[model samples]
Target: MSAKTKYTDEPIGPVKVIPDFLPPPEELVFKEDTVKVTIALSRESVEFFKREARKHDTQYQKMIRRLLDAYAVAHSKAKQNEITAKRPARRR
Candidate 1:
């Protein structure tokens, strides 16, 4: 007598199984204290961003975020000074 196989011999086209429909798997974790930002730019700038992103192996939006964050931190005082100096003098 021959032993029967437990698995099927037919080929499956594609698997549509979702492992974690209700929650993330053990290897995946969620961050709760993250901030989300949205920026709008021209198509040309977006292409430039994508190129830079590829060079750094990062997403374009992440590159923009890093740049904006650094600029805000480094130039906040200078920006404030410029805005204050631009205000017109009030007449007596």
Candidate 2:
């Protein structure tokens, strides 16, 4: 075992204000109504989410819900785009 090393006093550089380039956090939120339903899953599947949830410190049910929500949103957008593509373009 070695003793802790001592450090000489060092000065920090002056701080400069940087422009904020990220979007506001509020923009990311959209409330959605939810319904509760009972469902069954394989032990392996539940275990996987539970393990992942533990690592991230969140409920497995919430993670599963978000995954389903994202899937539905993506598929809905793709379907909308496909339908739009099939319609004739309007004259300017």
Candidate 3:
């Protein structure tokens, strides 16, 4: 049997009060506008995602979705920049 911890009344020196760094309950839950689509993918791509998802301990479909979302966001930003760069400067 293990020995019980002894009770002590000694004050802990230099206690620091830490602020709450956690997000609120509403923010904690992520809600995204998603739509279901039926599409076919190459066997090799699906297999690759599945293998990676197994190694990372996450769902394969989720990994694929995140990858597509990131790709879309990156391309959207790039397209916006391209358009802005192509525009002529306005004269005062």
Candidate 4:
């Protein structure tokens, strides 16, 4: 058995008040524009996502969507860089 905690009435030194740094309730709820699509994926891939999702306690479809979104974002930035690199410098 553990010893019981003792309560003290001692003053806890100077305290600073911090402003609210969190967003409002409405802003806390994120709403993303999404579209429904039907596509066939390999059984192995689907199973993999399902297993991972179950382990993380989240929806498998969300994991797949986030993966695809991340891939698209990364590739898009790389494509933009390639395009900029190919552009000739102005003879100002």
Top model by lDDT, which number? Answer: 4
Residue 63 in model 1: lDDT: 71
State the lDDT of candidate 2 residue by residue for 65-91, as single tens digits.
878876787779789999999999999
- Candidate 3 or 2, higher TM-score: 2
* Candidate 4 residue spans exceeding 4 A from truth: 1-29
Indicate the worst ten consecutive residues by lDDT in candidate 3: 19-28
Error of 3 at 1 (Å): 28
Instruction: Give stretches of model 1 more than 4 Å off.
Output: 1-34, 79-92
lDDT per model, in order? Answer: 0.73, 0.84, 0.85, 0.86
TM-score of each: 0.44, 0.66, 0.64, 0.66
Q: lDDT ranking from best to worst?
A: 4, 3, 2, 1
Residue runs of model 2 more than 4 Å from their true location after superposition? 1-24, 27-31
For model 2 the TM-score comes to 0.66
